[model samples]
Target: MTSLDIAFLATGAITVAAALLAVTTRHLVHSALWLVLALGGLAGCYLVLGAELVALVQVLVYVGAVVVLVIFAMMLTRAPIGPSPDHSTSRLHRLLAAVLGAGVTALLLAVLLPLGGEVVARTPVSTTGIAEDIFGTWVWPFEALSLLLLIALIGAFAVSRLTRPAGEVRR
Candidate 1:
């Protein structure tokens, strides 16, 4: 097999292993670290697929900002850093989840494999076109996302303030 095929296989394996670890790890911090590895593997896959912009954004936005925020929130809330509380689901629930996941996977494979052959023939649009479409047709959603970020920032600030010692009142 080609080097590219080998690299893809290796990355895919790492991604799956990291994902499994993230779900199965009892320690909250260890789970988050495994999640970071899984996300990094995804970025590597994006790079392999020749989507450098997507890869960079995935690393920056997901690994950098979102994960950091999650870690900070965990610290702020004084969540137990030790093993998580035992919260095993019933066997029936596990069976249902497995069946649902299998159905979704089969459906996606059926739909996507047929469409994949057509994607190679299409000419890629310029980055500017993507920007214009987002700023023009999707302006409202873009603005809403910005507003959501603002609200999150305000909420974080409010929560941190509330958690502070009562004797240290803000001016």
Candidate 2:
């Protein structure tokens, strides 16, 4: 096999292992760290596929911003830095998750392998054209995403404020 094939296989394995660890780990911090590894693996996959912008955004948005925010929230809440109290998943939930994941994988393969008809091939469009298309045709979704981020920020502030200790409450 080619080097690209080998790299893809390795990254895929790392992603899966990290995802499993993220789900199964008893400690929340460890789970978040595992998620970082998973996101890193995804970024590597994007790089392999020649999507430098996507890879950079994946690393910056997921690893740098989102995960850091999650860790900071954990610290702010004074959540248990050790293993979580509830690590056991019910059999039904486990089965449901497995079925959902398998179904999604099968659907993706079915749609992309042959039925999609060469959609994965790199297009010749320039980055400026792509940006223009997004800004022109997909402006609503972009604005909605910004609004969603604003709402999330507000919610985080509200949660932090509500969870403050009694004696530490600020006016």
Collision count for each candidate, in order: 0, 0
lDDT of 1 at 144: 82
lDDT (10s digit) by residue, model 1, range 86-138 = 54566798799878888999999999999877746657766577557766897
Per-residue lDDT of candidate 2, residues 1-171 (tens digit): 999999988998999999999987878899999999999999999788766766886898779877877787776555676775465588898899989989999999988789656556766756676567667897898678658766766666667666556689443
- Global lDDT of each candidate: 0.77, 0.80
Worst 10 residues of 2 by lDDT: 162-171
On lDDT, the leading prediction is 2
Give the poorly placed runs of model 2, Cα more than 4 Å off: 86-88, 103-122, 131-147, 163-171
- Judged by whole-model lDDT over C-alpha atoms, candidate 1 comes out at 0.77
lDDT of 1 at 78: 56
